[model samples]
Target chain A: MRVGVVTFPGSLDDVDARRAVTLTGGEAVSLWHASDSLQGVDAVILPGGFSYGDYLRCGAIARFSPVMAEVIKAAHAGLPVLGICNGFQVLCEAHLLPGALIRSDRRTFYCKDQDLRVESTDTVWSNAFTPGQQINIIIKHGEGNYQADAETVKMLEDENRVVFRYINGNPNGSLHDIAGITNERGNVVGLMPHPEHNVDPVTAPTRDGIGFFESLARYLGALASRTQGGTA
Target chain B: MAKIIVDVMPKPEILDPQGKAITGSLARLGYSGLSVRQGKRFEIEVDGEITPERLEQATQAADSLLANTTIENYVVRVDQ
Candidate 1:
């Protein structure tokens, strides 16, 4: 399986995301923000970092990048895409997912190992974990608070699209303690936590974060075999 | 050239942490009975007379691209 990690100007975690993909037994491809292609990867990861110097707004400018045009099209076509932290902000700005991430209610940048609950495991990103399972991941950001209208929140709740919710306490005042969510199709997922940062046991608190990549591998492998079988 | 100014702000219902922090700081600095809401201002220069149709087009663009309608509201002004 091949996963593409996009690098926008000032992106800090594209390398880490690529490492996570490689560690999960997949080929990691580096994609550029100005490029118009995805390099034919099976999956894509929009990694974290302060893109464009966090100017104007987080992920606001990067949403207009050439690569994002392709990402938007591919994501809508049911491609597996994951956005982490700043990448999550880009996803929201791109309107790939609903809601918006505002400044943290605490009014300061926060960095900590966060506890998250797997609220929905049906998506390609969370399918490897059982629903309701708890995982520890790292979250570091100033504008990490997530907000949406009441109707949209209710719709997300009704559709079971809330993928991850903050456990123990709501760190950034995200409505409904939402840490992550998926689009209606479940192929696109975005979260404010750094799952790639937690993939290595030596550096991170746990290896629990590797499940996201593993889940994608399993999904893509099954999909590939099915396509082959259909042709055969 | 006409300049279209668009101010994008967080919806009233959403929490404005930056605004709140600034408000607190202002209070600490002896300013009272005042509230602050932080937002972004965009100045768009277009080549044409600022007609109603052009203003309307600028307004639409501001609403769709300059602002995230899900969490924000924008006010567009046409300066001739």
Candidate 2:
């Protein structure tokens, strides 16, 4: 499967996302922010970074990018999209996902290892992990606080859309200790932690994050099999 | 040219760490009984007359680009 990684002007983690994708049995395609074409890739990832120098809001300007327009469209059409950190902010800004990320309530940047419990395995990104499984990953960001209205939070809870919940301690004062979440359809997943950084044994703390990439391959395999089974 | 000003602030329900930091600093400086919240202001110059339609345009701009309505409240008005 070909997974496209869109690089915005100030995106710093595209390379790492691409590496993680490649390591998990997918071809990584380089996508540009100015381009609207998705290169017919099976999946897309808006990696973490200070896009547009984080001007105006974390992901405000980047949300207006051409690639983002297409990504948003594709995501609504059921194409799996993963947004990490700044990417998550972009997803919220783009309205592909619910809620918004704000400056950490602690009034400080957080850069440390965080344990996240997998709350939902229905998304293409998290199907590899068992329910309630906890995985350690690196989280490094200044604005990782997630917020939304009471009704929306209630809906997310009722719908089982919360994909990841922070364990041990809430690093950034996210409501309900929410570190990540998915859409109703579970096609789009956004999170504050850096799963891309935890995918390799040589460079990362553990391979805990490889499940996110491996899950995509497994999902595609299941899809291809279903199609074949239908024809046969 | 008509200038439009957009003022944006964090929503009351949302926590404002930066604003709290400012308030804490103010307290440290002996500014008693004072609370502070931080926000942003944007000034945009329209090329033509400031009609009602132009005001609507500024409002839409504020909604789409100038501010994130999820955590912020913004007011767009023609600068007098």
Q: When superposed on Cα atoms, how far off is each prediction in RMSD?
A: 1.3, 1.0
What are the Cα lDDT values of the candidates?
0.92, 0.93
Report how far residue A198 has shifted in candidate 1, in Å. 0.9
Regions more than 4 Å wrong, model 2: none
Lowest lDDT sum, 10 consecutive residues, model 2 chain A, at A199-208
lDDT of each residue in A1-232, candidate 2, tens digit only: 9999999999999999999888877899999999999999999999999999999999999999999989988998999999999999999999988899999999789999899999999999999999999899999999999999999999999999999999999989999999999998998999999999998888777789989988888988998899999999
Query: What value does the lDDT take at residue A53 in candidate 1?
Result: 93
DockQ of 2: 0.91
Top TM-score model = 2
Measured against the true structure, the TM-scores of the candidates, in listed sequence, are 0.96, 0.98
Each model's fnat? 0.84, 0.89
| Fnat value of model 2 | 0.89
In terms of lDDT, which candidate is strongest? 2
